[model samples]
Target: MDPYAWSWNPEGLVVLLLAAGYVAALRRYPTPWWRPACFGVAMVLLLAVSVSPLHMLAMQYLLTVHLFQNVVLAEWAPLLVVLGLPPALAAAIARPSAMRLLTHPALALPVWLANYMIWHLPWVYDTALEHPSSLLHLEHALYFLTGLALWWSVVQDAPHELRAGTRAAVVFGAFVLVSPIGLVMALIPRAIYGFYVDAPKRLWGLSALQDQQLAGVLMALEQAVVFFAILAFWFARFFAEEDRREEIDRSPEAA
Candidate 1:
């Protein structure tokens, strides 16, 4: 594949079709407009980074682009998917005690962290790149799945799920745990991924070390954006819930 030009991925076509099918199902059993809207945005983001020319750039040219792509898939897309999940579907998920436990911080956090670290290891990273024909799609799928699990504990609205306070702690602690990987990547002066060392630069004037640093900054900045947004939401929600309870407490005595 030409690193600079548009390319048709069979997988991309399959994904687009599947996304369309999902949307059609949502229409048949529609929730609110916002649910489909969130889902549509997720699909667009998935296609933008995974199927578009951006994927080519990441695969062939820059580690920065690769990390950015992963961030979009892992962090951004899955969150939207969570928001878009139908109430009916969520209700079904509420039944299984074991499955519910999977979303707890203890389980979900470690699974996400382990899968993420495993993929980033030097040899694992290189091997995935080396077998782009096979392993690359699996790599992206793993990131997206782990991401879904990571956010599940924190984002669920079901009564069976973690309380808002616990969810907030889980998400914040995850940021503290995961941010260092990006920091190390951004602060390093030398190239960390040997795969890109001799690769030809396609668009940017960046050298390999610069590309790695850019990837790191992307990792750090994106995590900051997503984590802080969620935290702000939790803060407001926690205060609002507390105020509501106090208001009820202060209501006039009833017969």
Candidate 2:
């Protein structure tokens, strides 16, 4: 049995089912034509990195490939999936009691942070790479669950105001926290993982050092793009609201 066969079979099936379910759920809402289109594009990009031929080809160069996979799974994929507002589907899944337990403030916050910390540990990361079939599953599950929790806090279909400033702060704070991990990976002179150092290079004229540097660059760039994009969105919203407020205040109705 091919160890990575699960990626093609089970993973692909899950992605398809999720996509179908998302479409079904959106039928009740008058979602604009473009919203599902955007979600589809994001899903394509994500799965291309994970389950497609690109992933298979890249895996020949373990370091670069694994880094690509990690960024897609942790950053790009999660952000896109969250933007899809799948929590509406989630809201459908749970009864009142289950929903209360799942979204409870005390349980949710700690689980959110703990999930983030657990996945980033060097030991856990290396172990996943070595045992991709077993440990990798755990790593992916943690990534997905933590991502759901984080996005739920911001984007869930709930009667809550996620202040623009606060959301920007959260995005940047996450970027800052994850940045040190990239720095550590870049600073290390030797290969941290034996699997990568042992695997044959598939890409053009790139040594292990080059591969590692590329990975670090990918990590830094991905974080900057995501964080700053969210920050700018919030800032724009803030200014727009301020302008509207000023316009309202200038009216003579108050006098």
Candidate 3:
């Protein structure tokens, strides 16, 4: 089989089922058009990265592509999924005790960070990639789940609304903690994951070390853009809240 040729992944079934469930939910609980649109876009993105040639490229050919796929799974898709959840639905989901505990900022942040850090460790990363029984699928699953949990505290206003300042802090802290991983990968002198080095297909004539560096750079850049945008949004909200409070204080009724 041609390494770069388009390949289909059975994993697309997971995305399809999720889309179907969301459609059913929409029928029962009508929402603004944008909600479903956000969800549809996210599902399509998930399908594209998982079911399309991107999946095959990441699995068999390039570390750079794999890193890109990981970012989409762990960040973009989860964020969009959270954005798509209507307030009523989010509140209902959060009513479950287990979900409340899982999405709590205290637990969610650390777990998400750990999930990300542990998977990227050289031995662990290689081991997952080396076997078809490949802990890889598990890794991807955890990434998506933890990513969802991580965003819950920031995005979902129904279960518990964090103060705007607090949300900004959360985003900033997460960026601070996670940024180093990619920076280290980019700066490291050698390719850390042995699996990529031994893989049969080398695309674009990139050496293993070069590919590793490229992946790290891409990961770092993407994280910076996404995290900073979120931070800015929360900061704007924080300032707006403060302005509203000041206006209330200045009102004749307050005096």
Top TM-score model? 3
In the range 3-71, model 3's lDDT, one tens digit per residue, is 666655555778899889888887777889898888888898888778678877888878998888888
Per-residue CA lDDT of model 2 for 1-255, tens digit only, reads 232332462555666777887787787754656667756865786677657765554444546566666666666666666566544554654336655554443454556556656665756666666676677766766666666555555545442345666555656666676776666667778666555566654355666776776777776776688768877887787788878889898886766
RMSD of 3: 1.5
Residues 53-95, candidate 1, lDDT per residue (tens digit)?
Answer: 8888888888888898888777888888878878776656656
TM-score of each: 0.89, 0.79, 0.95
**Predicted model with the maximum lDDT:** 3
The lDDT values for all models are: 0.79, 0.63, 0.87
**Where's the lowest-lDDT run of ten residues in candidate 3?**
1-10
lDDT of 1: 0.79
What ranges in model 1 sit over 4 Å off?
A: 93-98, 248-255
Q: Sort all candidates by TM-score, best to worst.
A: 3, 1, 2
lDDT of 2 at 125: 63
